[model samples]
Target: MTIKQHQSPHTIGRNFRLIAGILALAACAKPANATDVFRFEGFGAISRGMGGVATAYDTGLSGMMTNPATLSLMETGSEIQLGFDFVSTDIEVKNKATGEHVSSDSHGNNRHPYFAPQIAYGRQIGSLTLGAGVFAQGGLGTEYGRDSFLSRASGNLDTELGNSSRLLVLNIPLAASYKVSESLTLGAGVDATWQGLNLDLLLGADQVGSLMGAGRVSGSLVPVLGGLPDLRGAHFSLTRNSPIKSGVSAWGHTARVGMTYAFSEDTRVGVAYTAKSRVADMEGRATLTAIDGVAGQIALPGDITIRDFQMPAVLNLGLSQRVSDKLDVAVDVSRVYWSDVMKDIKVGFVSDSGGDINILLPQDYRDQTVLAVGAAYRASDKWTLRGGFRIAQQALRGSTLFAVVPAVPKKHVSLGAGYAFSERASLDFAWSHAFEEQMDNEGTPNTSAPIRVNHSQDNVTLVYSYRF
Candidate 1:
């Protein structure tokens, strides 16, 4: 899908009851941000092969996050895995600026590399199989350099704004599967997840200079139209120490449970659910400073504590069939309860000079269902191939809260491959590209101006696995 917009991320701070972190992006009744992207989806090859299905029969390492029921699927000997991913994102935005009424087009780059490790061990102790592992799941991130259109607008509006965000989770998982009778296996596990959220917003005269992203930058007269002040002549310090950033630390827990049953030798069914979590210990703080013109700028101190804001609960039910000895297929139906995510947030101002607090919120969304299907084929003792598809529903509730975080059309396709280098070692590679639907962004500071954006995703992953 095409990517666009961050105005939505700011809303999480406006309300506490919606999303978990005032520091993280706000939760919407719809998709949070059309432009927001996740890199964790393809950190490893196995996740790509089965459309991220492993909650029941997971193996290798990263399986820890895909499902807890997979505990019993592990080999008695331990397995360790190493993985890495490279992403190249390109985003185009059409902007309405301060001085010029004419619209301008700007482009940006998303460059980042990620590393992940996964390990799992299982042993038969009488009637039960047990396993444990730690792995990374999906989250959101954005690092936008200040650009010309935004800079000119910031200088004229008397605002300094730059943002950086990161979110990661440490998953402590414990699970077991017990075989009852001859045809049923029941399993469950709790993923005691501790989430870490961080955000940084910077402002100053150089905010424009940074957005333009060139040499030592400078700001001139504040541009104006009808009724407004021209507070100008601010030269910003480009030092890292001058600008300030605000952040939060939050903690919470969620659970997952599942059961797998075989109707025949070639057919099996699986069901699982992940619980929702709330962060009560979320702490926040913002720093204040000036780069060039301190006399005219706003001096501010940030705030932190809020209510039980956080992510939602998710559930999945699946069916897998072995059509032949070398061919296998599976399908999963999943749900996400995004309606529990509505909140209003606030940001404190130094002088209250044209400022009260930054207040905004996400709209009421509904539960959404996804239909995902995948297949795996064994070409030989050393080679395997995989493919999958998923249809994600747009559960947006059209309202004022939906303005900033516009949802996009949902559907995805993936392909992957695996090769055994030895009896204990293998290499895997996978790639997926999502098609985006066209959408319009309306009602900015300017009511008539429109930002048209489309969404698309290109994901590639590589993994190394050694099965002992």
Candidate 2:
């Protein structure tokens, strides 16, 4: 046999891998949010539908960062996929005073129906596979009406009163996997991460004083809190609008490495480590609006900046097993180093009269562990069904949870399905819902009285793929 004839198949695979690499890199860009404070369990429709079980299982390019070694399982040809997710989130805050109990009315808030997009491609050659993708990894945000009960309690009568936040990370991962043996593969990737943030806040002076502590505030704030005869029992309302007034964005880079081992034809396990993306400070526009029943109104022009903002590293492990020809199951566990990057949220503002003001909101967040399990069933050559469950430990508690980000839910249920339209094309769909969870802090030093926040979410994802 001639060498050219023997190498024909390998040559074709190499060409396919090169074409896939070019397409994947050319399509890399931004998209938009998922899990934790703004972290997602999975990146594509198949994985999300399977309760984020991509770490060990082969789910096309979506598993690159989760476990790049999964790429070695791909077919010799090239494949491309695009996915979109629609997310809805809800947040509620309740305040308790001596005689008054008020809950935030955020029904039909209309801030949700968020859209996130993702794309990826992969190809296999002789013993190597290469790929790249753009994924919207994580984000958090909430919206409330101006006439909500919380707004009224905060003393907003002339204008709207609400607090909202948007944190998004776009990751571009360039990855390669090498098949060391028939059952073992190793892979690694470099990630270029882009992060964006927008914060709109309205806090009562009492709440601010509690969070900032008395020592951090100037003596002038004491008189406004009720020392003056005309200002007794009077409160100041602080307003910060950053999304529209002033926007904040930053870019950083990180990397991940992983390995996958196949114990048998029906079982496999994978592990991976992702480094933190160190980003710059986020600066935006802010205004402090204080409404005093006795002194009328006070507005201060300032800028809001949060320093040393970063995303923490993660360690992930996964296992996948095929119980039968028709049934497959997978599980994943992850440890998130939140305390490394979220120890404190420092808010600094510079005003025309007050000069420079700095407030340190202590997060002291604890590390979190996430668990996920999923099952997929192949009923027929053209039809597949999937179901999954996921849960994560809370990173913060008590007053700190309510004072900072309070929308991290603890549990989720997911369902998904796939249909093959042709020999080379398929459609996938997934739906996941987070159960409502709440945390309450009663008379904590970080909060004057009692404060509680409730949160939940619903997500739908769809993707289309073609292989050649």
Candidate 3:
């Protein structure tokens, strides 16, 4: 953590404290209730309003997350931007055979209307621009009450069988861009990321049997108690209320490279590649509760480890054009290599009472292709209007295990506005709505009945910026 030599000691100390504060805030933040398979469609208000298009166009300091090369396109000065997103998600899971539905909104503990904060600063020096920021990458979560069918199916009809799952990722990026020529810019960045997961889940005997039949369960418990003759009515659960208090979390790192080229003064093209993240195993403590018809119920405190969980690599290509002096249009295409990273999630549990169990949750997610298109109109000297559309292919491959962590929305529409109130201050606001999507798991191995999940989401972002 070194600051520029020209800065005074007091300034350096203040900056260090600021970074620490940012990390603390990010640690307590919740998931965004993702739109693109656990990933947000956009990063900042400017990008959200313009359909997540920032590769080829200047999008203030927030461009560090999308296309760092665009940093060089900013006005020659120092700029700071601060913003937050209010996310509202609607999710429902239904057991088609039982005709019972559980809505996330039904639970009093359901943490809806999640908030994600964003802050960034960039400065221009000679032909180079340097910037840094903290923001959320993306995440997914769901909550079901104890009275839901899932809890009843677990044979915990009277007990408080808390059922929920949450996954969150936050990123702090340090980026820089160099203007190679009047028409070309090159940039790169390094990201320090923190990822956390909390799960309070219960699995029924049939589901466990299916997993065992598929060879997805292993460890000491399997060889010992797994062979018991009366294991037919068994139930298993791992419960943790909060990630910060007692859940699995890890820190990881990644990098990005991007370049922007101007075909003409009115048209530009940008390309960016983000490498996959390398995260440590998420390890934490939870209560592993087991219940069986013959052996009754037992609760064992244990440690759990989630192995080799990582984010997918992505490639983005974008084109921006000035349709008129007052109108600008942009389109972007992105490919996410999800299959490589989301094949399966392996969890290993070790209890103090000498119980070792390994479980595999199959994701089998496919690669995703996303397309975004947006336009901005300068209505007056102080006002600008923006609108955009985005679409993506389904990533999950019909896995019944995804019922709790559904990321099913595939289409989104957004609208935004920007207002300049003074020579050095401006405000931007954007809203995005994801259409409801439903998916069914008919042929999945772990389910006795078909499971259907419906998901929809809304995001609103407001940002204020100042230039000096």
Q: Which candidate leads the pack in TM-score?
A: 3
Give, for candidate 3, the lowest lDDT window spanning 10 residues. Answer: 1-10
lDDT of each candidate versus the true structure: 0.48, 0.69, 0.78
Candidate 2 residue lDDT tens string, 187-257: 99998888766554555546555654645444344444444333212122232243222246667888999
RMSD after CA superposition, every candidate? 13.3, 7.2, 5.7
In model 2, the Cα lDDT at residue 467 comes to 71
- lDDT agreement of model 3 with the native: 0.78
lDDT of 1 by residue, 1-468 (tens): 011323233432332222123112211111112211222342257656666555444434555444555445555555555554333332223432222221111111111222233444445565677666655544433343343333333334434343334444455567667767455767766766555444433433333333224322212212211012432222221112211122554566667777777788788777777777655555555443333332444344444333355556778777778899888888777777766654322222222232222222324566677776778888887788888876777665333212123344466677899877555556777776566654544532211233443445555566665554
Expressed as tens digits, the lDDT of each residue in 1-468 for candidate 3 is: 011224445744564465445435433333348788877888888899988888898778888998899999988899988777766778888888778898875253334334667889999999999999998888877777667766654443334566777777888999999999999999999999888887766666667778888989988877655554444333334434433332788899999999999989999999999899999999988766665556655677878899999989999999999999899999999999999998888888998889799988778889999999999998887788999999999888765546677788999999999877555666788999999999888634445457888888888877777676
Which of the two, 2 or 3, has more TM-score?
Answer: 3
What's the candidate order when arranged by decreasing lDDT?
3, 2, 1
Candidate 3 residue pairs in backbone clash = none
**True-structure lDDT of candidate 2:** 0.69
Q: Provide the TM-score for each candidate, comma-separated.
A: 0.69, 0.81, 0.89
Candidate 2: give its CA RMSD in angstroms.
7.2
Model 1 error, position 163 (Å): 4.2
